[model samples]
Target: MPTPAATTTDLTGRLAVVTGAANGIGRASAIHLARNGADVVLIDIHESGLAETAEEIGRLRRAAHPMRVDCTDNAQIVDAFQRIEREIKSVDILLNNVGQSARERASEFWCSEPETWDFILKLNLYTAMTCSRQVVPGMRERRSGKIISIASEAAYMGSQGVADYAAAKAGIIGLTRALARELAPFHVNVNAVCPGPIRTAAADRLPIWEQYLKETPMGFAGEPQDVANVVVFFASDQSRYITGQSLIVNGGRWWS
Candidate 1:
């Protein structure tokens, strides 16, 4: 097999906008893009973490613009992206990474309240959709763009509990594929990344963290960098012909 290092090329003049970039996969993806020579815009509700992440990118001599906004709020997301375009110019790559479950623990769909379901759906599904709407217009005007969503492997499997969460993630994949078809004429690419058990802070707080490890075939959790590398690939020209694809980044473990 060919080594991954050999496949990447310099992203000298590209600009990538990453949401939910305060930590976890989002942070890692921003670092990877900056290292590869892409100007980065970091968006997250966590102001301190966002600034820290931007500083890390700055150390690499990359321009890092940090924006603090509640992704779940449509108005905030709208204003944020508008400012991004006005000040930074068109976004060449849009990383729709702002998503979260209502709670860390799983909840049975039948027993869950409608309010819980609403929160989960809005966060996981609407955030991506809302952000995409803002960025795609600029992309279309330029006749070039890429949209990469951070979906979940739970979308593919009938994962028990968290039914609302699973459904929302599934919706992302659907949106990616459909949007790809519409945006293809403008030379815009759309794709999704479905990562498995990544050992992020949220996962560490899980009650059954140990149990998850036991099921992973790799016997360890995946790191944020692992997913980050893939996001860079999707954002790069190397994947020019690839769109509407969902890359599953599980450590050889399948849980359903």
Candidate 2:
């Protein structure tokens, strides 16, 4: 088998923008890109974690710019992207990784509250839209770009409590498909990755995550790198012909 480095060219001059990159799969993906020679721009709401992530990437001798911005805010997203373009030059890759989940509870379309419903949509779906819209214009101008959104397995399998989050993620899947079709003419590939049972700090807070792992086909919880590796594939030339698809890194949890 070819070494991972041999599978992708040196991304030395390429600029990559990764949102929610302060920790978890986002952090791993940003680091992986840097290891392979891509200059990375890390954006997250968590300023301290962003700083730590940037420092680690710097240790790899790769250029890393860490910024704090609310991805759900349109003006903030616009300003951040423009600043990155001006300072880092251009963005060749965009990873929309910002996501949040609320405590799951019994609910149906009939009993859902408006506040929870809008919060889920605004945080998950609108955030991705704001970031994608900012980076895509320049990508279209260059006639080349790669965009990846991190989704979740619940969107497909239907989690019991997080109805709002699942609906938002399902919307992300649709958005990925639509954007891929629209941007195909510009040579931009857009896709989403659905990760299940990855052991992150946040995962520790949820009791259901362990139950999900107990039922996984692989019989083990995943590490951040497992998901990061797939994201790297979608962002690289190896996946040039792939678009509008959702690659599940759930270790056979859902089989689809």
Candidate 3:
């Protein structure tokens, strides 16, 4: 049997791969992971943002490898992971964080185009599956790993004008539970973090930003770091016994 994770939160010597690490929660989570002593591999399509994130991690004295890959493309994802395995090391933690609501094209579901739904589903759901596929083999072989995907409260609350986004994120929760069950025997943990009303660059651009704040029970929007803290918990030994669970980080918005 594989050895268990240590009882503390220290991530020393562990290698973590975080997608969408260019900014927002992805960037925050990567930084937090590094602060906890884990070397991180940052993946994103934005080169400038990746560089900035890497620089910050460098200041923390933790190894950070930034890879600019369009995660929506399966070929690119496969190629990138191949490079990761060859150049870096096997990933001990995989953060499937690349997703978008495609707010630019937001419309009522009846008015939504198939093209928009396609983009939303691919970016929000398929990317997680593809990225997880890359690391699952190695993790299963090693009999230990952590896979965390960033889902959204919209999945449960059923927000308007984002049906596609909600469906995609809901798919993430479903994927987490199924994969967790499948990998549990190998000591791998699969989980989802669902954030609500976090004040991200993307969220700030939403037309309903003011409405979201009003609806939030906390009476204020959350920061990316708020969600990042929960992510760090799942990434550390603190969550070793937790799997197939979706932990909501929204402040009193919805209860599970």
Candidate 4:
């Protein structure tokens, strides 16, 4: 087994495409990969934020490319992959990091708006499927690739107010397993990191964050880097023999 220090240095020269890279775990993952010598392309729906990420990564003496893409749209997703292929030549790693969670009570689908449920499904689950579809062909041809999806711990331990979110995350786990089996022949690994409550800007306003912290075994929620580090591990050659797995990094709050 490779030690942590050894794995950090193994990602050098890899090319990674990280979706939802404008902020939070995605941004940190892109930066972390760059710091370790990977050329990164940041993808997100936010144009200005993506530019800022690119600028910051450029300051680190590593290359960063940002593209504003609505990943839920299959046409747009396909086009972005093609553009990246033509412009960057190859994408050795893919981080499906875009996700949305609802605060509505769980098991209350009767009260959920159809539009809201649809949007959450498209954002959290279908987008991963669409993006992976575009990238796997190239990976199969190259006979090497890493596909890492960011899942939530709620997928395992159901949450109170996120039925759609939990369902989508569980769906992602199933997708990861199926893809792993399908891609194993080509040496492409598919996995997910299910993080517990993270203190990102988007979740800062939630009143329940403190409650989650209190319940956590570590006595605190996690940071983006906590999740990013696991992502980097799955995306690198260090995990050449690991696949079809979901590594839960939840501060020991929940273990299976």
Candidate 5:
């Protein structure tokens, strides 16, 4: 039988791939993993942010490869994974982090447009589907891998204006749970982290900050690290027995 996976949190000698890693939770997660001794691959569409993240990874003395790709583009997704297999060699962990909600104030669902719906579905939903597909082969071959995705509380709470965003993120949760059941026999764990009101520049521009604040019992917005910490646990063997589960990192905001 294959040896048991490491239950400790140390990621030395492991390789991790994080999507949407230009800033916020993505950036924090990449650095945190690197600090714990994992070589990281950062993927995002923002060239400047990717460069900055790469430079910081360099300072940490861990290998960081930045790949720029429009998350919605299937061809670019394939190319990114091919480069990862060629350059990074293997993917011990995959963090599906590319996502966004439309920047607008509260409005009725009727105001949602098809263009917006399509954009939200592609970024928040399809990106994870494609990226996860890319890594499953290698993981299945080795009979081990960790897949951690960044979902959101809006998925469960049902944010009114960003209905598309909520639906897409909810789809991620469904994907994680379903994939976990299939991948479990291969020793690959799949789980998701649902963050609430993370205080990032993007969050600042959110139209419903007050709504989030009122929902959060902690009386403050969560930071990127708050979400990243749970991600690290899920990515490591520390969460070996946990699968098909979604953890809400909202500091007691939403229980579901």
Candidate 6:
């Protein structure tokens, strides 16, 4: 009988594409993926930050392709993925990490403006859908891939003032389940990582930062790497049997 292969988190030779790879969880996850042996494609609107992340990954002796893509614009996303296909050939893992809460415009549901809601939904939900479409066909044909999205704890445990953000994230969880089932037979695993208040530049700018710290049962917010750790797990073969699930990394904020 042949010896069984050891279960490990070795992503060597895989190519991972991470949206919003300019900073926070995206940057952390991208770097972590590279550390584990995967070459990464960094996609973000922030050119300088993408360069910085690419530099860090290059130091790991892995290839890093940085692309400046305004995710909210479907045209840009289509163009970017076209370039990805032409230049990189294939994508083994995809991290849909681009999201925003529009905290500065947070308000009562009744007071929220249509434009604000549109912006929030476009940035958070639509971008994920668009990006997934770009890679799903190839993944299905190849019969192996991983799709991980960065959702939020707000999706499950509702929050005041950010209803649009919460709704968008909930949509992500819904998408994950449906896509997971559809792609399961093809060996594609789809999952979402719902992070609570992680210590990111965006989180620090939110007005409810203090409130988030107080609510977390762990007594403090988590770091970006905390979520990145989970991202790496889902991206690897170690999570081969897990799909259509939302893993929360919010320091016990919600027990789902």
Q: Which lDDT values do the candidates have, in the order given?
A: 0.88, 0.87, 0.93, 0.86, 0.89, 0.94
Leading candidate by lDDT:
6
lDDT measured at residue 227 in model 1 versus the true structure, 0 to 100: 95
lDDT of 2: 0.87
> Model 5: residues >4 Å from true position, as ranges?
1-6
lDDT of 6: 0.94
lDDT string for model 4 (53-134, tens) is: 8988899888898988988777988899899999886888999999868643334666777777788889989999998998
lDDT of 3 by residue, 1-256 (tens): 4887568779999999999999999999999999999999999999999999999999999999999999889999999999989998889999999998978899899989999999999999999999999999999999999999999999999888999999999999999999999999999999999999999999999998898888788788899999888888999889988999998878788632
Count the clashes in each prediction: 0, 2, 0, 0, 0, 0
Q: Report the lDDT of model 4 for residue 11.
A: 70
Q: lDDT tens digits, residues 1-256, model 2?
A: 2443435645678888999999998999999988878889999999999999999999999999999988767788889988987877888998989887865533665788888888778878998988898888988999999999999998999876788888999999999999999999998999999988899988877867778888899998999899888887888888877999998888898732
Decoy 2 TM-score against native: 0.92
TM-score of 3: 0.97
- Candidate 1: tens digits of C-alpha lDDT, residues 1-256: 2444544647879889999999999999998999999999999999999999999999999999999999879999999988988898778989999887656546777678888888888888999999999989888889898899999988987566768888999999999999999999998999999988898988787676687788888889999999999998999878877888999998886753
Where does model 4 exceed 4 Å of error? Answer: 1-8, 103-108
Clashing pairs in 1: none
Better of 2 and 4 by lDDT: 2
Give the clashing pairs for model 5.
none
RMSD of each: 3.4, 3.5, 1.9, 2.9, 2.0, 1.7
Number of clashing residue pairs, candidate 1: 0
Deviation from native of the Cα of residue 226 in model 4, angstroms: 0.4
Q: Which ten residues in a row have the lowest lDDT in candidate 6?
A: 1-10
TM-score order of candidates, best first? 6, 3, 5, 1, 4, 2
Between prediction 1 and prediction 6, which has the larger TM-score? 6
Q: What is residue 155's positional error in candidate 6, in angstroms?
A: 0.5
